[model samples]
Target: MDLLSDSALMLKVKSGDNHTLGLLYERYKKRLFGFFFQMCKDASLCEDLVQNVFIRVLKYKHTYTEESNFLSWIFKIARNVYYDHFKAAAKNKASDVDELYDLKSSDNVEKEMEQNEKMMLLKKAISKLPDDKKEIILLSKIKGLKHKEIGEVINCSEGNARTRVHRALNDLKDIYLTLEKR
Candidate 1:
């Protein structure tokens, strides 16, 4: 029901109410996809990763606990899935033509093109970052998780999470500038 909290819904899922997971899936599917999209350049692979996260949630449903934050729990599983895929695909980096995220449009065509170019450069810069920093940036910026939530995802204190986000942003900016210069 609409009033059921995510934890309650997940508890239902853990209790063998298999259909309840679909509700969780609906609630989180887009955010999950967005997370994967920023982490990965391949659209199809991103889709697969989203499916894998749910598959993991279902496979490991018995472990769900009432005290656990459902969003953090699911993201931990998703992070693992991403790491597994990342290791497996480390040697085969390839890019596709599809835009990773949507670009805002304005009335001025020249500005739009310039903005598109800048975004592409930024994506390239993001790709150059180490995996952990990249994940932090995506979680903080793209996913809009607060420092405390990010700490939960990365298993650190909130202050540490804030520092990591700050460091990651600085690193990203450096990479973006270097790429832009070339």
Candidate 2:
């Protein structure tokens, strides 16, 4: 079984193949953990959240539809989990923080550090954007999703997704330029 293709694995998983589900979990665990880490900024909490996502997937395997992209379906669950975490954190009066990527063992740590610094600046600039623009940029640039994939995730048409991404990129560029002048 090819583990990387989510749809095929999902079909198997839905058909009483527990091993296929395990394969899917192994394939996505690291990337989804990284995504949650970036979103929630707490390694331990992100770990729990990632586990929760997989657990929920297991518990709700029967709920998955054939027409849905498996990746989008999983991400939608992750998004919901993040929102719940966000709300609970807000209620606890915790400050929202961005998690910085660890590059401690990179060959060129200095250059990596410099690049990460720039990325932090870009993240800050992106966060200042409106919600729709921020979502579009994050989905496209950070998640590396195609326009059609993004549309599937966001429940919009592909054309709308493309236009949204283009406008968001333009707005982000303007923001970056403004920040450069300051």
Candidate 3:
């Protein structure tokens, strides 16, 4: 078989080729986990969310159309999974976004410490953003999704996705600068 694109694999999955789901999983597991980790900042929860997304894919497989973009479809499911998880849980117990920060490897201890501090500030800034802005930033900057794909995932027009992303980056910069002063 030729190297199948994500959409192709999903099409196979929709056609009852269950093994294709494994191929899709292998390709996207890390990306999906990273996406979830950025939001929840809990490894175990992110793992569960990833599983939920795939399970959703399976449960909703019949809804998949050949024209649908698989990545956008899966991410929509992920967004729903996140929403459901948060909705069911108490707010006080939500994952602490700060805990997601990790220090970069550096021979100089000072530089490593500085980098870690910066990362924490950035994560905190990102965490402070409103949910819509945060999701746009994650989908655009972190996941490298195009405006069209983001639009599909978020159910907005391409123009709206671009505008939201621009606004989100501006908001994030402002928040980050404010945090830096503290």
| TM-scores for all predictions | 0.82, 0.71, 0.84
lDDT of 3 by residue, 104-173 (tens): 5677688777977788888888778887788788888645479999999999999999999999999999
On lDDT, the leading prediction is 3
Query: Where does candidate 1 have its weakest 10-residue lDDT segment?
Result: 92-101
Each model's lDDT comes to 0.84, 0.73, 0.85
Error of 2 at 92 (Å): 10
Write down the lDDT that model 1 would get.
0.84
lDDT of 1 by residue, 19-47 (tens): 99899999899889888877776779889
Backbone clash pairs for candidate 1 read: none
Cand. 3 Cα-lDDT: 0.85
lDDT ranking from best candidate downward: 3, 1, 2
Instruction: Write model 2 residue lDDT over 58-164, tens digit each, in one string.
Output: 78889887786887788767767767776776443232325443324556778887776677667667656665576566667635478888887778999999999
Per-residue lDDT of 141 in model 1: 70
Per-residue lDDT, model 2, residue 140, is 70
